[model samples]
Structure formats: C-alpha cells, structure tokens
Target: MIPAAHAPTPARRLTVEQVLTGRLVQPLFQPIVDLTTGMVVGLEALARGPAGTVLEFPDRLFAAAIDAGCLGALDLLCSERSLECAIAATTPPPLLFTNAEPAVLDQPLSPHLIELVGGGLPFRQVVEFTERALSAVPGSMLRIAGQTQRWGNGLALDDVGVDPMSLAFLPLVEPEVIKLDMSLLRDPDGDHTRSVCAVVRAEADRTGALVVAEGIETPGDLDTARLLGAQWGQGWLFGRPAGIEQRHRYDASAADLLRPARPGFHERSERAYDCAVDAATPSVATRAEVVAALSRLRDVVAAHDTAVVVMSSADTGLPGVALSLAELASSGRPVIVLDQPATTEFVVAAIAPGRGCAVGLRTSNVLELVTVDDLPTVAVMARALLNRHR
Candidate 1:
C-alpha cells in the first residue's frame, strides 16, 4: 500500500515563518563557467535556511513550505532575495539566474518588487522553471513565460532531462537557456542520456538556445558537457556556490557569450496555427467511436506523461470516458472536472504537446479533439477553462 506523505513539523513551520519574517534565508551564488574559455559566465543564486538549522537544506526547506501551504510565499522570497543578493555582490553579475516555483509564477510580486520593476532591474535576469512543471502545467507555464518576457528577462527550462515530456514542449517554451540535469552528466553515454542530449542539441541548433550543464566536478565531466553540446557549465569543479562575502572574479565576456540567444527569448512563439474547434465539422465520430479513439490516445500519451484533461463534472457518466480519465489521472496526468451546468453535457477530449487531441462530442464535448494545427494552444485553453470554472 502507498504510505501517506509526511507533513511539516510544528518546529519546521515556525522556522519557515521566522525565516520569511526575519529574512534569514541566505543566498549563495554558484559560478556558471564557459566550458571552452573557462570564464565565469553566470551566477545561479542558491537559497539556504539559517546555517545549522533543521531547514538548512533547500529540499527540506521547500518540502516544509509546501506541506505548510506556504510554498508560493517562500518561492517569492527566494526569487526576490536571489535577485537582490546578486545585485549587491561585490562584483557586478553578467547574468543573474533566479528560479521560480511554478506554483508561485502567477502570484503577484511584493510591493517593493513592483516598484523595482518600474525603476528597472539593475542586472540581466533569467527566470528558470523546471521541465516537470512544463509538462504538469503547460497552461500556467505559457502564461508566466509571456509575463516573464514582458518583464524583460530571459526564460530558462531547468532540469531538462528529468521530464522527457518537456522535449515535446521546447517549441512552446522557447527557453533562452536549457539547463541539463546532473543525471545526464553521470551517464552521458546511456541511451536515455543520448536521446535527451540529441533532443536538446536539436532545439539549440535550430534556435541557437544556450545550454548549461550541472554537476560538473571533474575535468572529465567538463568533457561530457561539451559532448552534450553545452556551452556553459556549473558545478564544484568551477567553484561551489559561495556567499557574497567570498570574492569571485568574472570575465567580461560572460554576457557576450549568451547575448545571441536573447533575441529568441523576446521573439514571439514559434508554433503558429489555429486551435478553434467547430462542432459542425461533420468529422466527429459517434460517442462509442470517440471513446475508443480517446482510449488509445490516452494509452499513448500516458506513456509520454503528457496531456492535461479537463471536463465538466456532470459529464463523467459517459460509458468509457470516466474510466479513461481515472487511468489518465492515475498515470500522473492532470484531469480537472469542472461543475456541470444544469442542462449542459459533453464528451471527453485529451490535449497534449505530443499527440493532437483526440475525441469529439455529441453536443458539447468537454474538450473536443483537433488536428496538430496547434496542440499547445488547446492545452492552454483547457487549463483556462478549468481556471475560469474555479
């Protein structure tokens, strides 16, 4: 049997409150070096709780915040501190990389930050979002990506290999930099690693997006990063993440190396196509046919761990759809069912980046299937529908 997850201890909850209220979390900067030139190209701000505390480790600190239902608050605190700490460093940063938890990407910034936006930030900021969130919450990811660009910062897809589904989303995210997970560095020659490297290289080749590899402690690991076509790398081999008190020297060429990819960040999305569904298209199959086809689509998409399904709660009575949704949700895909209208009814639809949506409705299908004209937009619309319903 699956065990229940643990909740944060009262002590941990108190630690979180103190950490936020007192601004006790320390920000550490790790140098991202250019592999070829061995220059400090960027500094990624790493956060830590007060030294020697139970919540000193970031993983533990975030887990506690999540359990305490304060992850959004903590995420904002980290992002704001990361930027401010980097700006106040002894040396000016060429590029400042700040991470935002997907949950908090949509939340409003602090008033101080809002005012800072008007005055303009002092450094080039790159916002990193995890690849898992790209697949888990495509709609939220897209909206935040747009807002991030509007704020004049770069967007990065972090831990790219952790979620294979994210490879399909590269076109949609169009990140300025692709940060590879350390697992790829440990076994760069493995089949999974090779496949991920190929996909990342393809995106980089086509779009000129910069690639930075993590967990590089050895010169041999540096070679592996180059083999993966990574232009920049970060890990202990260069230097472990350090506090502002530590004096770190950076090369003037750091921004020059990454500037070419900046345009891709500010450009419009690459995939362009219409996703509107017309009910009278006359191609939609009968209810049974749609159920069988969507079942097949579910089996395929579930393997990729992609697709977010949304439906009206009142429509689950359809013969095969409810069972299919159960399987989809079990596979760890999102399946949001909104409250049903008094007289409204629809069938099932599954929208994902990989395969075009499948299934059509008799009257008003929950999410109608469509061709690959533009699957990402359909997924966003699906999420927007759920948000509106909420």
Candidate 2:
C-alpha cells in the first residue's frame, strides 16, 4: 500500500549472529526489594547490548532477535552471560532471577540450562517466563517449571496480565512468583487494573505464590502496589538496572524473615495477643462464620494471657498475610493460624513462608490435639512450643 521508498525500516542493531560471535550481550542486575523493610530480597538479571548500540536496551535487542529468527539463541546467550556475571558480582545475593524464552526452553540444551545454573552456583535461581513465551508453549513452560523446581530453583511468571492467555496458563505452570505488569498500576484509578490485582491476589492466596510489582517508577506506583497486595517490588524507583559495580545497596538486617526471636519473646507474643486484633479469610466460603469463630477463639486465647489479633485477608492474599506476619514476627509476636481440617495442606503451604512465631491448627482437630476440657491449655502449649523453637 506504500511506495518502496517510504517503507518502514527496521531499527539498526547487532545481528543475531554478530551478537553471539561478538558476545555483545551483557547482563545487568536490578534489585527486587521487600517494600516494608527496604531489604534486597533478590536481583533480576537483565540483558543489555553494548553501550551506544541500537540494541542497548533489551526490547530493541530482542526485537531484532525475533525478526532474525534467532530469539532462542539470544535467550541462551543472555542466560549464560547472566550466570557468568552473577557469579562474578561482588557479594552476590541469595537469589538470581533470569529470563528465558519459550523456544529456548523447548530446545534441547547442549550443556543443559540447569547445569549452567546449578553447577556450583551458590545462589538460588529463578527462571522467569515471559508472557509471550507462556502463551505460546504452555506445555514446555510446565515442563521447564517442574524441572527447575526439582533442581531447587524457583519459577516466575513474568509480565502477568500482559496477555489474556497468561491467566489460562497460570494454573498449569503454577509458578512460585508472579511479576505483575507495570501498566496495570500506571493508572491507579483504572477499575480494570484494580480488578486484575484482586484476581492476582486471590490466585496467589490459593497457590501460596509471591507477588512482585514490576515497573514501579514513582512513589505513587509503589504505594498502589503495596495497597494491592504486592509485598515485593522492582522498578527504577528503587534503582535502575546496572552492572555489579553499581548494584543497589540495601539494609539486609531490616528484614527479619530469617531472624530468630529473642529469648523473652513469649511474653511479648502474649502481650501482642492481648491488644486489639483483626482477622480475614478470603478463601472461606462464609466470611461471617469465620469472623465469629475467630472472635470466640480470640477470647479463649486471651484468657490464657495470649493476646489475639485477626487481620482481614479479604483484599491482599497470602502476601497480605505475609506482610502482616512479618511485622508481627519482627516485633516478637506469635500468630496462630487456624483453618478448616480439609484445607490444612493449602493452609500450611501458604503460611509457612511467613516470618513469625506461629503455629497452624485445624479447627476440627484443635480439641483432639489438646484436651478440650482445658481450652486455656492450648494457648499455654502454643506459647511453650513457640518459645522452645525460639
């Protein structure tokens, strides 16, 4: 429809062959932090071309690779280089997140992608699958996810909500991390965005997965993400992607997820239980019933010198629970998670990741576990077990 002279030209960049032969692809790391404590939880490895080149940015680099029918090769190069760079980085963190195209995952690896990742690398790896890749080869995604998990690595669903197919693929892949697309939060008032977050929150709650908000550029973006149930976040607002020399610094001690409670924490947990508390359950079929049960149970626990607070889980999912638990646990508070007997497996998986002096109990079996004649005995035993672990 247009003249030959007016035809659109593709951007000039390194050819796929050139990039592979020249090794022009470099890995840049970006910190994904726990917003509540400003702790650097993980670093996502991003691919960048040589400075001053058309492919300097990753989008441009991948666009060229897609046009040249060499996207797989580029993805492989990026993965390998990311591992190399991460290993060489000064004081590498515990988790190194990397990206992989679906096609690359489908192909048989010479050295094997897992080998490159697990071969004496000290850090746990998270392989993020792009939206396009998830949409195209869901079967491969599931296979790769299982393979990675088997190796003790993590799997992330990248750019969630960018494609309609992502939702369909989610249950099948069942990734450990979900990176929400930034566009969803670009406009805070968008009903569609809020609805998407609500859905993600529920899914994460049901699956016990972590939520990471991507593309946070401003304070508002971070705030909205926090409100929408994302405990971990990544964006330029924290720090731009950079080489190891420019890696973002964080106060690792600020996060107390792995910290042990002090010796006298039992009295503190009992004190916290006595204060005002809130409760929430998003998955429960009847909200009123759960609230009433928690209310009565709170009274019983309080009688034994243990304060109880029941935070609502209606809006935020497990992340909401985790964030709440982190705050409570950091202050030496003990949390008791009560769930229906049938849902014990799901409840355990979801709440196990939270940082707190906590115990999970099935509602119907509570009496069986402890003598029903002495309800106060339950609280005493809980506090004793928590203290023993501490």
The per-residue C-alpha lDDT of model 2 at residue 61 equals 88
Q: Write the per-residue lDDT of candidate 2 for residues 185-204, one digit (tens) a residue.
A: 78656875776677678768
CA deviation > 4 Å runs, candidate 2: 1-14, 250-390
Alpha-carbon RMSD, each predicted model: 8.1, 14.9
Please, what is the whole-model Cα lDDT of each candidate in the order they appear?
A: 0.66, 0.57
Per-residue C-alpha lDDT of model 1 across residues 1-390, encoded as one tens digit per residue: 544466433443346878888877888888888888887877888988877678888998898888888898888788777877776666767788888787666566777665554456666678888876654555556566656677766778899888676676665566889999999999988998998888788778766789999999998999989998899999999999888556666776665555343332323232111122431232445555656665675675576554545543344455554455556455646434442322333433354444445333434554333332235444433443333332
Q: Please give each candidate's TM-score.
A: 0.71, 0.59
Q: In lDDT terms, how accurate is model 2?
A: 0.57
Candidate 1 stretches with Cα past 4 Å from truth are: 1-14, 64-69, 135-138, 245-370, 373-390
